[model samples]
Target: MGSVEVPSRHKALVYDSPGKISTKIEEIDTPKPGVGEVLVNLTHTGVCHSDMGVMCNSWAWLPAPTAQGQVGGHEGVGVVASLGPGTENSNVKVGDRVGIKWIASACGNCEPCLVGADANCTSAKISGYYTPGTFQQFALAPAHYVTPIPDSLASDMAAPMLCGGVTVYSALRKSGAKPGDWVVIPGAGGGLGHLALQIGARGMGFRMIGIDMGEKEQLVKDCGAEKFLNLANYSRDDEGTKKLVEDVKAITGGPGVAAVVVCTASNVAYAQGLSFLKFRGTLVCVGVPEGPSVPIATANPAAMLAQELRIVGSAVGNRQDAKETLDMAARGVVKTHFEVQPMDKLTEVFERMDKGKLQGRVVLDLSG
Candidate 1:
């Protein structure tokens, strides 16, 4: 097979202590790719909130606590370094740029895989969890599963699109809102929300309403949100929720928006989701709430039946969704607002993300 000069060892950022924000940079031996896998020389990886959840052991839905010394990142972009056995017919080869997403590998024979719901595949291996992830210089991904990076898109720019971009696009599709319909995103200026706004407005033709802090107003508007609602302006009380619902109805004529895609982990956003949708509208749950899982406050059967509303959970997108998302990026219909940081700053980046201080996404330069 074609090859590149790969070193024996490489730098990796690992979660030194799970259930907390601690990371250590260490040199570890790089392994050769196994069957149907490719060794990737990762140049850039996006630091996502999901990684923070994995490190902190905060997401209750996960099967188990993250193991110590686990490399933690999913949105990785790199070039193929070497091919493993039985990959001669694969679409990717040595020197081709590719990306690894949340789902590192999936058994193509699974029911979910057959239906294009790879995130729910029974044998799915999630990167940055139990599987070795992309917070390292070298990582292994299935040759058939890696996403092809478009020539027009830079690796750093394409990193976040692998996870956050495709995730929101999938959630938007599940939202069931058509062109010219009004859709609400709770964390509209966030890493996922900003991309959702751009894709919904520019790519899918939906009119977006962004809800976030006052500081995020400009960014949300710039990302194509037709209206920005400051979350701080509304108190977390019944009266406040009523007022917000009324305001949403006023903004979208009478009833309410066609859908409310909650992109924040805040339970308050999930509670307010159902109240923002019109009759027969959908509430697509995208963000995973950390800590103990709580039921949505307004998801009672009465409320659900009153409007014939539907609520669906969306994980990361499938391979087709990833391709479509990248296509949109290559065509300039969507763009991620991000800052580049060295690998050592990952802890600080996670801290900022935990405190809701990040403006968009942060791509780690793994070359360090």
Candidate 2:
């Protein structure tokens, strides 16, 4: 495959103010792919909550604050417009559809990469952070690392699956719940939660219980949750937490769920996550809480020993996980509930997302 008609400049959405909710559309010079890389002509990108975290410099765990004018997006889908040196014999070629995810590139020689944990790669370049990201007309990805979008899936639908879908799927895989087991998901109507519900119930055959606000009950059930718990009904106090835990246990017939996947950024969800798991059950943490870090209040030593509970943290998926996730979407096993918006609406999308007003994911059309 040969290079296509490449543009010298293209439009991109940049974080004008690093510590606030602001984005500006600017025409930046298009970049050529380096050796063993491919330039992707992105047509669609998903606006993730993590992107907001980056823009606001909220996540303390990140090494440094986000710089102004950084393109802030990780879930981008498009086609290969050109390939650089050393990629001539690679599987990816010009015009082949692909997707870029959170972990932009990982040094294959790192310890984490050797263990197949790309998300924790010591030298990982995170998309939409210091490295240039997908919220633009074109972006570059390593030839060997880019996720190939399934031919049967549309670009708009494939965008959110790159991050939200793959993250939840990887978390579900780490959850240790088998088919027919009961699994609970906190924030089940949010972007990652809804996908977890569908993948857990339909793709993996787990009996899913969803927890969220009252308004999201129907959407949660529609996404394959066998039971829905309204967060609004329970107060944010200890007694209220006890009641919620009891309810979850009751729904699972006195024994708690086989696993609890906390998919929301709320610290309250993490505090209650371990309580909903049965003996020897697992609690998989997939959400990154904003602001100062807080320990899980319910994760006491005595309780952990008594129940033999296991807790694990999952980041975004690796290359293989991304492939499986897209395959699932291709087969109609999982679908993201999303609305398409133009590039200029990026700021409004972040504003609504920050307030929890978004019902599902939002995909940005980069055509404008």
- What lDDT does the true structure give each of the candidates? 0.94, 0.94
Model 2, span 1-368: residue lDDT tens: 35567799999999999999999999999999999999999999999999999999999999888998999899999889999999999999999999999999999898889999898899899999998999999999999989998889999999999999999999999999999999999999999999999999999999999999988899999999989999999999999999999999999999899999998999999999999989999999999999999999889999999999999989998888999999999999999999999999999999998889888899999989
lDDT of 1 by residue, 1-368 (tens): 35678999999999999999999999999999999999999999999999999999998878888999999999999999999999999888899999999999999898998998998999899999999898999999999999999999999999999999999999999999999999999999999999999999999999999999999999999999999899789888999999999999999998899999988898889988999999999999999988777788888899899899999989989999999999999999999999999999999999999899999999999998
Clashing residue pairs, backbone N/CA/C < 3 A, model 1: none
Per-prediction TM-score to the true structure, in the order listed: 0.98, 0.98
Off by over 4 Å in 1: 1-3
The local lDDT score (0 to 100) that residue 203 gets in candidate 1 is 94
**For model 2, the run of ten residues with the poorest summed lDDT:** 1-10
Clashing residue pairs in candidate 2 are: none
TM-score result, candidate 2: 0.98
Summed over model 2, clashes come to 0
